[model samples]
Target: MKAGYVIRDQERPHFITITVVDWIDIFTRKNYREIISNCFRFCIKNKGMILYGYVIMSNHIHLIVQSRDGKLSDLIRDFKKFTANQILAALHNEPESRREWILERFAKATETHTRNKNFQVWQYGNHAEEIFSLKFMWNKLNYIHLNPVRSGIVEKAIHYIDSSARNYADEKGVLDITLAENPVTDTRKNSEFWKYNSYED
Candidate 1:
């Protein structure tokens, strides 16, 4: 487990990256992707987790998140644990073509790591950086939203259904995220940062 990047303030928003074990492309399937989306909604509604921005990539996910109940660490821990089990079940019970291969891979990953149980679906540590200022927040937000665009998955960031770019673009997205309050930079309709604020692309 990585000991670095501790959360000093549980209520403060942080940019987080959760990656799959061995960087596996587990989310290549639509079902697996939907599983993650459902988990996000569940966490938001019941775990006191605040979803600010997010993007689900093929093998990992980026999130701008905070907690209202002062249980950010616990929430994330449970989220990973639950998703791993749920996804493993899906691999076994669903019509996955690479079911056997994927299971073997997960099992192998567990054998080498003492922290894991039967299988290790997600990596142990998350790359977390606290969002302290408006500029930093915007920069990370743009990076998350533009991941798919940079990877050639979409021409526009808003077109990616698995990201918060749709929400920022003023469209009803998969998960509803709270816009940051009192952005240091003016996010008004006529402001210079309006294009990036509301995600023009």
Candidate 2:
């Protein structure tokens, strides 16, 4: 497991990339995709975090986000917890027989997580890498947008229905959203230098 996300160069906001437990492909189905999308939509609507660019790989998700109105860790924890429960319930009650096989996979990956009653839908580490410079964010954004292309699944970034690539490319997503400003620059990203106000240590 990755070490807990540290405030690397805490002078700016961070870009976090988290993977599924044991690289389980929980999102092979559309119902799973909807669950993840709902979590993103909820975070944006509630003004808890700024949803930037993202790409959904088979087993992981990448996000460029910054905390607002509260701690970033809490926001992510809530998101993971909610999605895990909802997705798990869907596996149980949603009459999708294919889900039985998926549940078996999830169970296998979560064996270690189930110890001490932990619901191990997702891996524990929320891999956060702070993004302080524009150049770095630029690269990360392009990396995110081009993930599908890199995988040879599609020739274009917007072709993937599971990503924010369409929104960033100025097309509306099925879920609907205004484009997240490209190059992902903002006061939030630069607020780290003065985070002393919110710092306790």
Top candidate on TM-score is: 1
lDDT score for candidate 1 against the true structure: 0.83
lDDT, candidate 1, 118-189, per-residue tens: 888998777888898977887788789888888998877777899988777678998888876536444354
**Local accuracy of candidate 2 as per-residue lDDT tens digits, 87-137:** 889888877766666667667775654442534677777778877676677
Q: Rate the local accuracy (lDDT) of all candidates.
A: 0.83, 0.69
Score every model by TM-score.
0.89, 0.77
- The 10-residue segment with the lowest total lDDT in model 2: 191-200
Query: Clash totals for all models, in order?
Result: 0, 0
Give the TM-score (vs. native) of candidate 2: 0.77
What is the TM-score of candidate 1? 0.89
List residue ranges in candidate 2 displaced over 4 A: 1-4, 8-12, 108-118, 175-201
